[model samples]
Each structure stands twice: as C-alpha cells, then as structure tokens.
Target: MNADRTKYLNRRALMGAAAASLGLAAVPALAQDNSTEMDAPSTGPVHNNTSSFRMLDWRPYFSDTRNGAILVDTTSRALHFWSEDQSIYKLYPTSVPLTEDLTRRGRTEVVQKVVGPTWRPTPAMKERNPEWPDFVPAGPENPLGTHALYLSWTYYRIHGTHDTRKIGRRSSNGCVGLYNEHIAVLFGLTKVGTQVLLV
Candidate 1:
C-alpha cells in the first residue's frame, strides 16, 4: 500500500508538470495573434466633417522662463510644455490615436506652427473620407480646430480638434488631438523649432 501511494503521487505530479508545459507552449502562439490583431487598420468609414463640434474654453498663462519645447506622452495621455530655462511650465491631458502595429517613442522637433489651420486630407485620408472636401476652411467647424503644431514629419500634426471628447481616448486617425483651449495655450508656448518628445 505504501508503494502504491508513492506511485500515485508521482503520477499526479507528472500530470501537473505536463499541463503547465502545455500552457507555457500555448502562450507564444496567443501572443503572436494578439500582435496581428493590433496591427490591423481600424474599420468603418470616417465620421462627419462638420465644425458643429464645440470647442473647449481654455485659459492661457505663460511663465517668464523659456522652456525649449514640448513633450507629448501618448501612453499617459499628457502633454508637458517645458521652458528651456526651466524643467516644467505646464502639463495638459492629451490623446493620440494609433494603429494596431504602431509604436513611437522618443523626441522630434516641431517644424512649424499654424493657427486656425486648414485641413487638407492626404490621398490616403481622402480615400478614407471621400466625402471630405478637398480643403476644410478654418473656423469652429474645422477639424483642425484653432491651432496646429506641425511635426518634423510632413503628415503628422499636433492640432486642436472640435472633437474634445477624444482628448482622453485613442481615437484620432494618426495625429495628436488636443482640446481646443489647451491647444491654444500650447500654440502660444511653442514655435517652429519646438522639440516634441513622444514616449
């Protein structure tokens, strides 16, 4: 009976180890599929392009200290406006919509800044928003909102959007979307040579 009990215990231990190994082997396959899902493009047609969107009321203040540029943290959904002279000046919540396979980290310069900018959909964007006019005029109706900080990259712009609700969510086609009032403050703080660090 003693020998039988030892054999039974060993068999149970071996079964448990085999089960754990099977689970470990399955993990890589599941991880691979999850990555593939994230890489997929978002579905559905683009929504309305009207300026009926309400703008956020933002109040702006400046510090005498000159911070060099801006840093946008998409994961944390925050924007840090720093003065070159000081470590920090202002911080605002922001949002970025990314593709499933998208990955961006580190810093880049802001090459240009525009106020009340127009929206010119890229050929790819146009394909997605066929109903979108060739150019959207500047105003409350414009998706670009009241300010835009053009990044070093041609197509990517950090701009205010009429869609204020998107500020905390990952929802933009690719651009960084800010609240109208927050963007206006950012516009005042930054210039063509501003550095944008994304992490």
Candidate 2:
C-alpha cells in the first residue's frame, strides 16, 4: 500500500484501540495533518488568539474520565479537556509526532503549568538539529506557543505551537502541540496535579 493509505490504516487501528480502552461510544472521524517542513513558521508573539479549527465535543467520551483530567488520543491527534464533573469537555486538535518510542501511554500527572514558557531543546533535539539554541525564549519563534502543561513524564508536554497550521499533525518531538488559543483554554482548566492519560 501507499504511504498515505498506510498512515490512514495505522491511525484507524490506533484510534480503535484507544476508543475501546476508554469505552468511548464512538470515535469521530479525524482530519489528517498535512503540515510539512517546507511550510513557513510563524514570527512574533501571538496573543489572545481564538481558534477556528475543529475540536471534539468530549462529553460523550468523558463521562467516565476524572474531573479536570486530560486524555490524549494520539491516533486522532486530539486532546480532551474534562471539566470538573466530566459532564463537559472541550477538545482540541494536536500534533503527535510519529517517532520511535515517542508515545507516552499510561497515567501521569501535570507537574507544571507555564505561561509563555521558555523552551530548552533536549539533547535528542539538539542532536537532530545542532543549529537549535540551548534555549528558545518564549515568543512566536518558540515552539512552545502560548501555554504549556508539563507532564510528570520527563520531556513530555501538552503545549501550544507558534505555527497554527501544525495542529492536528504528527509533527512534534514527542510533545503534544495545540493551537495557541486552544492551549489557553486548557491551561485555565487544568491544575498542577490534574491527571493525564495518554493512549
């Protein structure tokens, strides 16, 4: 099969598994991320931005989830934000890179919530791109976008991206990338100790 077809098939399998594990009534059809390296990155800071991108209404899938919990569906490249009662939730498109051992499946907690987060590329990132700085001050140029939720798992985060188009694509170095506007909403709803489940 061709690459595109292979990707679709793989995502379908993964999504199926996640829905089953979570007891989701159904998994909505998701859009494929077509972002490429050739696309130009955004410049300068983006503040108070609102999203026009598609997001899932997570209420149906969140009934069994913990209040104020976060559940990431890697296959769908979506993040579910549960409300205080799991009766309501907002979902956002995200970027989950298809790299080796990049999936951080299992239960974890939010270790930190940062606004305008400064990014320090990991050794792996530096090794991949030596030109990257040891630190990227939070700005439009920074990949961390507007807000960030640091997970207990080292080097994992659910954060925003400077490039709005990158959302819904598998384009991160393991971190989950949300739209700046979407991240702002998630940041407000989440706390330091909120549960996070990645599937």
**TM-score per candidate, in order?**
0.63, 0.68
Return the clash pairs for model 2, or none.
Answer: none
lDDT string for model 2 (1-199, tens) is: 9999999999999988887786552534432221111112322222232223334555544445554778788777777776767555576777776554656687888888899888887776666666766777778888888788888888888888877766766556777888788788789888888878887
**For candidate 1, lDDT tens digit of each residue in 44-137?**
4333322211111111223232336566666666666666665335666665654433345565778888887877766776676577667777
Per-model CA lDDT versus the true structure: 0.61, 0.69
lDDT assessment of candidate 1? 0.61
Off by over 4 Å in 1: 1-67, 101-104
